[model samples]
Target: MMAYYARRKLPTSCLCRVSELRRQFTSASPLFFQGTSSVLSNRVPSSAPEGTRLTGCNVFKNKDEPLALADEEYPDWLWEILDPEAQQKKLDADPERKAKREWRARMRRKIKTDNFLKTMS
Candidate 1:
């Protein structure tokens, strides 16, 4: 880990907070370098985005291109480590999306009928 940071020349302070990290947690975890005095606090990699490890050309700069989660992007690690029970609650509490889906389907049918009538007239 130190080797990677040294290669990148990042300091130990970069692992602090968002306002602090404003550009951290990119390619690797900052915790890995926190222990060693060899920590490097260099800015985020130039190859990556301003606040991320992925750069503009290499990454999606707009909604058309979304960043894929390293994991399920469901239960964050902090949630699992701090409150794992919350994960279970989410699965158990999927409330009924069926109602909303049905409403949307009905609205679509109405729209199609209205459009057809206007075309016929």
Candidate 2:
């Protein structure tokens, strides 16, 4: 566990969060680096499109899904797993977005501390 984070020297808070994330995904755990490769290999589209499909294009095959997850185009499943503060910071780096992310981070801290106080009481 020490070796895992030693490569990057991430802080203890980040390490605790990563451990929590590992516990969260324990049911369907896959190697952190190899992400979704096995899933992609086993995917089979239900039916072929009517017109000719282009080859060597990087576009997403699922027309039903949006092209990007950022810019508020994320799916519900993604939103569930995402850290809202991190997502906001990554998707929009403007001063307004920074303010919003900071507020959200503070709110989360407050909620967690409040819950801890409740448990203690």
Candidate 3:
């Protein structure tokens, strides 16, 4: 019980100990009783509701910035731009990506040739 008080801080007028809240946070349920049964439970804090830090947390709460968030039409989310069939077509179009294919072939052949061999060795 003392350990729980250490982990949880609830904003309530009652003289509830920290341990009670800490026990609630660790509960597996998404919902829990916050205040004393008499005080009535309401309101979740706006800051870090996920119970984690906002910056450098690695958990991407906002999917926009990483995925073209600046533009609504080209948002970084793949689902926003292409449906399943379109994604498949994009994959199928790889063979027609001539410039890249030619570049790769050129690179492979050039690896054993003079221009690359002299520079590498």
Candidate 1 residue spans exceeding 4 A from truth: 1-52, 57-96
Worst 10 residues of 2 by lDDT: 39-48
RMSD of 2: 17.4
Number of the candidate with higher TM-score, 1 or 3: 1
Q: What is the lDDT of residue 109 in candidate 3?
A: 88
lDDT of 3 by residue, 1-121 (tens): 4455335542232124233434434442333222222112332222223323323222245542221122223323322121233345555678667567678889888776967779887
What TM-score would every model get versus the actual structure? 0.27, 0.27, 0.20
Clash pairs for candidate 2: none
Going through the candidates in the order shown, the clash numbers are 7, 0, 4
For candidate 1, lDDT tens digit of each residue in 1-121?
5577557655433433322333333334544233222122321232223334322223223534233343323333322322224344544466465456668899999999999999999
Task: TM-score winner between 1 and 2, please give it.
Answer: 2
Best by lDDT: 2
lDDT score, candidate 2, position 101: 73
